[model samples]
Target: MDDLTGGGAPDSTGAPLLDVFMQGTTFFDMVLTGLPSQPVPGTEIHAEGMGSCPGGIANLAIAASRLGLRTGLASTFGDDVYGDFLWRTLEQEGVDLTRSQRVADWHSPVTVSLAVHRDRAMVTHAHSSPVPLAGLVSDTPITRIGFVSLDEEPEPWVSRAKAKGAKLFGDVGWDPSGRWAPEELTGLGDLHAFLPNSTEAMAYTRTEDPRAALMSLAELVPVVVVTCGGQGSIGIDSLTSEEEWVPSLPVNAVDATGAGDVFDAAFILGTLREWPLRNRMAFGNLCAALSVQQVGGSLAAPGWGDLADWLAGVRHAAAAGSRSAAVLANSYGFVADELPSHPAVSLRRAVATIARMSDA
Candidate 1:
C-alpha cells in the first residue's frame, strides 16, 4: 500500500503517478462492534470512534487522483468539527475540495456500520440530506475525466458534464421499500454506465436472480453493470454484439466494506483504456481481492502499481481461483446462508456438488 498522504508511485512503464482532484461529502462514521453475530435487540452500542475523509463522490475523486488524475470533490458539510476533519482528510488524500463548503450549523451525514461476519449492516442519519448550493457546477478547467460516480444526491453539473461528452457513471447503492425513505433516492436509468450490486438490483427489480434484474434494468439504461461479490461482476456493453461477464479474482477474505466501490473505480479505469471485458473484470477482481486482505474500506485499497505488479505475477492459479469463486457464487451466492439449514443449504453439500462436477 502507498502512503495515505500524497505520494508518487511509478507504473509498469516507469512513470510517476500522483493523486487527482474530486469533490464530495465527508461522512461521520458511527461504526459498531460485535461482528459475525446478529445485533441483539435492546443492546446498547457506542459510536466507538470517528474518521474523516471525502466519502461518496469524494471517494471516487480520491481514487481517480491516486491513479494520477487531478480530481476535485464538490459537496456540502456543516461547520461542525467533523466537517473540518473532512476537509483535512480530503487534502491528505490529494483530493481538491476547493468547491466544497462548510455550511453554518448544519450537521454532516453519519452512518453506523455493523458487521455480521461477511455481511454488513448500516444505519444512516443524513443530516445534510437537503444540501443546497448556489453554484453546483464547475467551470474549472479539468482534464479529460471520462469517469464519474455518485453515492447519492443529484448534481446538475453531472448532466452538463455528460453533455460536454464526459462519461457519467454511478452506483445505485440501495433503496429499501419498507424501511428507507424511497423518495430521497434517485432512479438509476439514463447513465453511460449504471452500476448496482445484487441487493440493490433485486430490490429495484423485485427479482432474485442477478441476470434477470440486470436484463430488466437494461430497458432503462444502455449499460447495466452489476457487482456480485464472489460471482465477480457482469455488464451489458451494447457497443459490442452481446453482454460481457467479468470473473472475480480470488483472495483470502476479511472485510467486505468498499469492495463494490473499489470494483466500480477499476471498471471505469478499464473502460477508459478500452480494455477487453476479461481484462476489465480482472482489474476489478484484483482490486477487490486486495481490498479484503486488510481491515476497513479505503485502507485496504491497493495502489495501482502494487496491484498491477501482483496481477502480472499470478497466472493459472488465479484463473482456477476465479472458477472457485464462480462455483460458490453459482451454487450459493457469496454468503454462507446454508449451514444452519441442512435440508437445502450447507457448505458441505455445496462442496460435494462441486466435487462431483469436477470429477465428472
Candidate 2:
C-alpha cells in the first residue's frame, strides 16, 4: 500500500494532493449472494449470504485508494443512518471526502443487489441529489486523473479539472433510454481516455465489430478501450499507434458489480505509471477478474496485497507443472516488477455488514 500511494504530496501550488478525483452519487448497497437461482415473479427466496457497502462512485474511489492511489470523492450524502454508514465506511477505507457534504432531510440512495449465476440484478431507489455535482467542487483540485460517466453532459467541474491538467477517463452505463445517441459522446474530445464495453462501444460507434468500434472511437479520444466480457478487451492508443488485445483471466465470478470500476482504477494506475499499453490492459483485466469473485462492490476491491498473493499463487502453480498456470504466470510476469518489497497484510476485504467494528 505504501508503494502504491503514488506519493500524493502537494507541489508548491498547495492544492489538495490527490492521484484520482471523482464526483458522483453514492448508494448504500445491499448485496445478497449464493442464491440457488433467480427468484420467480412474486416469489420469496432466501440467499445464502449477504453483504453491504458504499457503491456508485464510491466503487471507483475505493478501488483507486486500495491500490495506493491518493483518492478523493465529492458527492452529497443524506442525513440518515445509511448515509452515515457510507461516510464512515469510505473514510475508513482511506478515501478523502473533504469535498463531500451531508444534506439535511434528504434520503440516501439505496440499492438491493441479487447476485446469482455469476451475474447480478439490481433494484435501486434514488432521487436527484439536492445539490448538483458542479456545486460540490467549485475549484477542482490538482490531481493526476479524474473519472467521469458519459451517460449525460459533462459537468462544468470536469472541464475545470481538465484545465487544471487532470487527465480524464470516461465510462458509460447502460442507456435505459436505448437511444445510444452519437451526440451523447460529443464530449469525447475533452477526455484523455474512454472505456466502454463492446456493446456500448458498437452501439455508439454504429460499428458491427468491437475492433471497428475501437477504431472509430480512436478517432475521437486519444485512448479508446472496448471490453468484451469473457473474450477480453481491445484497446488503441492513437498517440503511439499501439493496439493491444488482452484476454480475460478465467475466474469463477460470484458477482460482477463494480468490476468495471475496479478495471478503470487499475488502468488509470497503469497509465499514471506510464506502463506499456498492453500491460495496462492486462493489469486492468486482472483487477476486474479478481473483483468479481466477491459479493460486495466497493468492499470487494482488491489491494496490492491481493495482487501479490495472486501472483505468488500463479507462480507456485506454474512450478507444479500446470500448463494454464504457467501461461498465466508468464503473461502477468510484469506484475512482479511493480509490487513492493513487502505488501501490506491488513488490507481491506468484503464484509457481511457495514457496522463499525474494532480492528481487534
Candidate 3:
C-alpha cells in the first residue's frame, strides 16, 4: 500500500481517484459556545464564543480528507452565501466536489447549535434536495470504501457501489417514529460494517446490553461497533471472530457536535490500513476525544498535524514523570510508527466566523 497520508492524483474530469465516496446533505453550521445554561423561552442570553462551518455529512468528508484520504462528496448546495462558504471550505480542505452540485434558487440548509456543559442542542431548517440521491450516484466512482446511512430498503447506489467492490460502512440516525423495526436493519446483511451508538444498537437489536447488541449486529454485518458515550466502544469482527472493547480517552471536551463523525472517519482510515481491530477502536476513540476539545464540526477535525502535536505533548509529559501521559503514550504507541514523517501544513481549524481566503 502507498503511504497512509498519500492520495492518487485526480482524473482528467477532476473527480478524485477516491479512497472514500459519500453522498449526503451538507448543512451550514453556526455553533455558539460558552453558554452558561440552556436559555429559557422569552429570555435574552449572550454567548461567549461562536464558530461556523460546513456540517452534516461534511463533517465525515472533511475528517476523512484531513486524515489524507482521497475523499469525494456528493451533496446539493444552495447558490446562496452559506452554500458558497461551504463549497470553498471543503475545496480548500482538498475534498473533491466533482460529484456535487449547487442549485440556482434552492436555499442552503442551516443549523444553529448551542454548546453547553460539553454537550449541545441544535435547531435546523432544511428542505428536500432538489436533486435525488440516484441522480448523484448514477455514475459512482470506484473507491476503497463507501460510507452511508442505513435505511429500511437499500438505495440503488448502495447496490451499485457494492457491486463495484467498495466495502460499505453504515450508520443510522435516530428513529423519530420510535418503531425501531427489525426490517429497518435488513440492509445490514449487505454492509461490511455497521456503527451505531449504544442506544441505537440496543433499540434495533432489542438487547439492553451494548455487547449483546454488538454480537447481534455482528451476525449480519462482518464488523459491528457500538459506541457507549464515556464508557467507550465495543466491536465484533465476525470475519476474524475477534471481539474487543476499547475505553474512551480522558479529555476536556468543549463541543461534541461532530465527535461521532470524527470517530467514524478515523475508524474507516484504520480499516483501510488493515490495522488490528483493537487498534482501530483505540484510534477512533482517540480521534473523537481530541475533536471534542474544540468548537465547530468539520473544521474541528484533527489532521495529521494535530495528531503529531498530541503525540509530542504526550511524550513530553511522560518524560516528565506524568503517569496519565505515560499510560496514554503506551496505549497510542502504534501511531508513532504510522504517522507520516512530515505532517501536512495549513490544516483546517475551527474559526469564529467564515472569512474570505485572503483574510484567512
| Deviation of model 3 at 150, angstroms | 0.5
lDDT of 2 by residue, 1-360 (tens): 224555466645454588889888999999999998889999998998888889999999999988888998998999998898889889888898878999988999999999988778899999998887778887767787888888865777788878889999999888878889888898898899999999999998899999999989998999998999888899999888899999999999988889888989999999988888999999999999998988788988898889999999999999999999999999999998888675575656656765655522
Candidate 1 runs further than 4 Å off: 1-24, 30-34, 42-54, 129-135, 138-153, 179-189, 312-360
lDDT of 2 at 216: 92
TM-score per candidate, chains pooled? 0.70, 0.94, 0.95
Candidate 2, number of clashes: 0
lDDT of 1: 0.55
Instruction: Rate residue 137 of model 2 by lDDT.
Output: 80
Arrange candidates, best TM-score first: 3, 2, 1
- Clashes counted in candidate 1 amount to 17
For residues 1-360, write the lDDT of model 3, one tens digit per residue: 455455676665556578888888899999999999999999989998889999999999999998888898989999998899999999988888888899889999999999998888998999987887558766757788988888634557667878989999999877879998878888888889999999999998999899888888887899998998789999998888889999998898888988889999999999998988999999999889888888898888998878988999999999999999999999999998878777458666767777876535
| Model 2 error, position 254 (Å) | 0.6
By descending lDDT, how would the candidates be arranged? Answer: 2, 3, 1
Relative to the true structure, candidate 2 reaches a TM of 0.94
Cα deviation of 245, candidate 3, in Å: 1.2
Write down the TM-score for model 3.
Answer: 0.95
Residue 167 shift from truth in candidate 2, angstroms = 1.0
